[model samples]
Target: MITIIKNKTLKTLALCCALGVNFALSGCGAGDSVQAQSNPSTLATKDLSAFVNTFWYVPQAYTLAYSYSSSTNPKTTAVSDQTIWHFTSANGGYLLGCSFTSTNNGASWTSATIVGSVTANNTVSLGFFGGLVTVGSGILTSSSGQPAFLMQMSSGIASTGLTHWAYMLPITSSDPSWSSLPATNNVSVPTATASGC
Candidate 1:
């Protein structure tokens, strides 16, 4: 379920809604951070707003939330302690509906209609997991092995190569985070004013 807040503005706001979720972890405080195991792009700094134009077709669910800023401020300077994410898939597995939007920068996001039921896995690349002022995941992780969230991007812990259909780990009732899964939109991409790609 996508939990929407009431502080919608522009780029950052929408990103927050899509990528905001304070896992309320115990061992890892808010200050704790994680890095992408491998980055595909040459960019030293990953600009998330770049995804505004470049959307991942069917993401298992966007994990690894982090904050990012470029050229001063992308659009506004509303720092978010939590990061919300947007994941998508063609097959109607988890989020069978179309992608969502937040006119007020995530004050509230509206869900779109579902178009299909053929699920597929998305690409798991470093480009998919880079750039962020901060970082966290819904998946309870350990120092070893890829975060469970990475599975959404590909097959197993070592998923690579081209993109394909794959299922996401089910968020059980025991988990302690506001998590949501797969959804996508190729044509209705949003334009972001933020410049941190």
Candidate 2:
């Protein structure tokens, strides 16, 4: 009877240890499943409409590029000047404005505003000089790895149109490069009634 009792006690101990191990392993698996569900595998598409009623700084060194033709300099010149891209929500689409810092003198900025139609892909068709001359199209895309706004614009006549600018703007001020472009002047969004989305 002593031997039988000893054997039964050992079996019970073994069973309890096995159950504890299984529970621990199952708990670990559950934690991993929850973590996987929280992190999405794909990123969502960002559009220009997401930036309505916002102003973004554009650093000339990394963000501004343009081509122009003139009597003295016919080639396109890439300038590093501070600028601000401001947007506003309108009836049909968004009104976009570009305000540039005065290079000739340290004075207030002069803004040129236009109405644009934004697409789901973040493509914008903004008129140049109030639609008198065509400025071409521009696009806004988000960086996959970083929380930044990427802008790409093309300008000039259709026959000689060139990629005007490609710039990166940080979405949050927490980013280290957020202050790279400082806003010195106030930019205002124009009231427009352009027919576009």
TM-score of each: 0.21, 0.45
Model 2, 1-197: lDDT tens digits are 01111123556545434555322222322112111122244333334555565555554455445545553355666543444555555444555654333222223443456556655445656654533244446665555564344445555564443354545453344643343333223222121112222
Best by lDDT: 2
Error of 2 at 181 (Å): 3.2
lDDT of 1: 0.27
Candidate 1: where is the Cα deviation over 4 Å?
A: 1-74, 79-107, 113-170, 178-197
Q: Which ten residues in a row have the lowest lDDT in candidate 1?
A: 131-140
Candidate 2: RMSD over Cα atoms?
Answer: 17.8
- Please state the error at residue 166 of candidate 1 in Å: 19
Error of 2 at 86 (Å): 1.6
C-alpha positional error of residue 58 in candidate 2 after TM-score superposition, expressed in Å: 1.6
lDDT of 1 by residue, 25-90 (tens): 222223333222333453433222222222222132432222233434442233211122333332
